[model samples]
Target: MADPTLPRADEAPGTIAAQVNKGQQFTSFDVNAFEIPNQREEVWRFTPFRRLRGLHDGTAVRTADPSIVVDGVTDGVTVETVGRDDQRLAEGGAPFDRVAAQAFSSFTDATVITVAKETELAEPVFVKVDGPGAGEVGFGHIQIRLEAFARAVIVLDQQGSGTYAENVQFVVGDHAHLTVVNVHDWADDAVHVAAHHIGVGRDAIVRHFAVSLGG
Candidate 1:
């Protein structure tokens, strides 16, 4: 089945997907909703557009699909790959940036991690997300959902090479506790643009850590 989030027939297959703007006024699942960023824009003034490897301008086409796998499944935790139409997607929030929206609207599938309500895992779940290759480009998304009163630790190890853009959502349920670590260790020439959207629920606690091993 075609994922609802993917571009429609009239829409270019992988380009111009996003409705959000520079001012952050509105958001949508459509790609044409966003304007391509240039060196002149305030939000983009400091970004090296050339270094993006065409992800921002829609010139980069996905050369490969990302490979996501977990070290092991712990009790009370379920990891599944779901289509973009999955209701659980974007639970934390909608795409707030053009790149983020593009990633959301372009990805065919998403990795969803769910911690059952009130269940605590004995060990952390390690997820490894690998990109296509050094010269390739790809778009992807991942989501972590914690049910009410649950507690868990997650380690996201992102590696491999390529020009990659992605969005990650963390939805913490009421009274749940979550701690996450994200490590970026791509090849020296690789390019990556990513957004991490976190939504903390009532009485929920979340701790996040990021490590960039490659400059």
Candidate 2:
């Protein structure tokens, strides 16, 4: 189906940003608030619906728990698994789309990583997520926070097989520097969709690098 509200001829490509602003906005965990995508919306237009394995339409269900591991822990860092109601979950930002909202709504636990102020890590933190298996669909959420003047580097490594949707949020405090690298190396049949949101504070430096080797 074609989009009913197409951009006018006079509208420049830059107008896309305004479309993003005008799109659905939700701050709470309610999947019912967002409409199911029909491949007409900006976000779903480019996505491969068949590859999603019913994640967008809500037919997918979690079959097995994926393995999540965090390595290279430092003294100044704290990591914890918190509930969705935790106040820290809202520190980053709200869900920006249906998949993000679904992820937040479906995930049983949320991972929070915090770097204390004025702390510098000698080694990079590594987060690895391994898919449950084929024919299983999973949802996950992760939040990373860097306190004022903290400096750190984080690497997210994804691999294995399954249909997965995830939301990752990064909040950088003033004068902090955070660099994130995401590496995707999944099985050929794996389907993974992830959205990343970053909130940078005054004078903060944030860098994101993505490397995809397989799907």
User: 21-50, model 1: which lDDT tens digit per residue?
Assistant: 554344445556677878787778899888
Candidate 2 stretches with Cα past 4 Å from truth are 1-28
Question: How far in Å is the alpha carbon of 76 misplaced in model 1?
Answer: 0.4
TM-score of 2: 0.85
lDDT of 2 by residue, 1-215 (tens): 53434434544221221233446343434565567887787757887787788777778877765778899998999999988788877767766567777777788788889999999998999999998788788888889999999999999999999888888999999999999999999999899888798999999999999999998
TM-score of 1: 0.85
Candidate 1 yields a Cα-based lDDT of 0.82
> Once superposed on the true structure, which residue ranges of model 1 sit more than 4 Å away at CA?
1-25
Residue pairs whose backbone atoms clash in candidate 1: 16-31, 17-31, 18-30, 18-31
